[model samples]
Target: MTTNTPLIELTAWMRGRLAERVARLIDAGHDPHTGPDLIITPLGTTGEPGTRADRSCDRCGRFVSQGCILYMITVQAAPRVLCVGGLCGACRRLEDGWQA
Candidate 1:
């Protein structure tokens, strides 16, 4: 299996977990619409080329300098398209378990 396969599965599992959490909240008589919004966004991959001076790495929370290579992560769920954040090269690899 490819590296992306596991990441994809992990995201799917997270979606299920989110659903369960929402169900529990509803069962406890909480107003669904009043509760915090639940969003399931897609994972970002490394190797894409981009640069952002004002963005921080989503995983490591480190600021990337201007002209530095960064990865753009976009999450798509139904009608929502969230352009989450950029990931530094190191964090991006670590996120995918590509680093030891």
Candidate 2:
């Protein structure tokens, strides 16, 4: 359990960053759900660590090719910590007012 503290902290930090970005987008009159400029850092994997492979975007259900950037999202819904891949960078930044 203690070994996972760092990963948990990292996840929390990432979530906070996402929240801030979303707030900024909202203030700018943009819909965050339609933007892909948000950064998604991959935390520790649910499978073997350090192993890389192609994955699908959990949000849009699109296949993400290898070498493409995939965002890692961790959702805590009580009694469960669901980790899933989010949109690819291009898809994530498709909306106006997206930074980066």
Candidate 3:
């Protein structure tokens, strides 16, 4: 028999992991209402190109410079604040193992 998890299951798993991560961020002083609201969108979706300067990877705390591929997460508190959290390329690739 073939061994392949369904796409739906993989998607759900990713979402759950992301939720847990966000919760951890909140617990680690990244609370949306009390701290900067991270507004993470796709790289191109932000109407800009390449990665943001001086933005570190929220997952591993690695310094990320421009031109590097990144996956960002957004933490928001409505009309209060907006900021961005990110994961460097290495972390992003590592996270891919979550599907397994």
Candidate 4:
């Protein structure tokens, strides 16, 4: 019989890694509230420390200014307090591993 190649093992490992990441995000997504990592920018307002809008993409980790896929992460204590993108569709695709 022909031997299975290392490619299969690599693919499996990659898939497993990706699946774990997705699962973590899903759990975070299922959270009902969010309030961490805020920057509250306006001196003393809830908007001051800023929000996840202040954070960047989970993939590229940079400021988003293109109105792309905004991931709603609810893993804290307030809703609408986090985001992942204003990325262009291309970058968004990349963030999603080109297949999300």
- Ranked candidates (lDDT, high to low): 1, 3, 2, 4
Error of 1 at 80 (Å): 4.7
How many residue pairs collide in each prediction?
Answer: 0, 3, 5, 15
- How high a TM-score does candidate 3 get? 0.35
Q: Write the per-residue lDDT of candidate 1 for residues 1-100, one digit (tens) a residue.
A: 1112234432443345345544555577654443344443323223344433336675565777777876875433222222245678986665455745
Q: Model 4 misses residue 76 by how many Å?
A: 18
lDDT of 3 by residue, 1-100 (tens): 2223323322343455456655555676655344443433222123234444336665566766766665774433222333345677776655455522
TM-score of each: 0.41, 0.32, 0.35, 0.25
Q: Which 10-residue window of candidate 4 scores lowest in summed lDDT?
A: 39-48
Off by over 4 Å in 4: 1-54, 65-69, 72-88, 95-100
Q: Cα lDDT for residue 87, model 4?
A: 37
Clashing pairs in 1: none
Who is ahead in lDDT, 1 or 4? 1
Residue 84 displacement (Å), model 3: 7.1
Q: Can you write out model 4's per-residue Cα lDDT over 15-70, one digit (the tens) per residue?
A: 44344444454576643234343411111112222465443443344544545454
- Cα RMSD, model 4: 14.1
| Full-model lDDT for every candidate | 0.49, 0.44, 0.47, 0.35
Compose the digit string of candidate 2's lDDT tens values, residues 37-88.
Answer: 4323333223343333336543345666677777654543212132344556
How far residue 30's Cα lies from its native spot in candidate 3, in Å, is 15
Cα deviation of 18 in candidate 4 (Å)? 4.6
Report the lDDT of model 2 for residue 100.
Answer: 77
Give candidate 3's root-mean-square deviation (CA, Å): 10.9
List the candidate 3 regions with Cα displacement exceeding 4 Å: 1-54, 74-84, 98-100
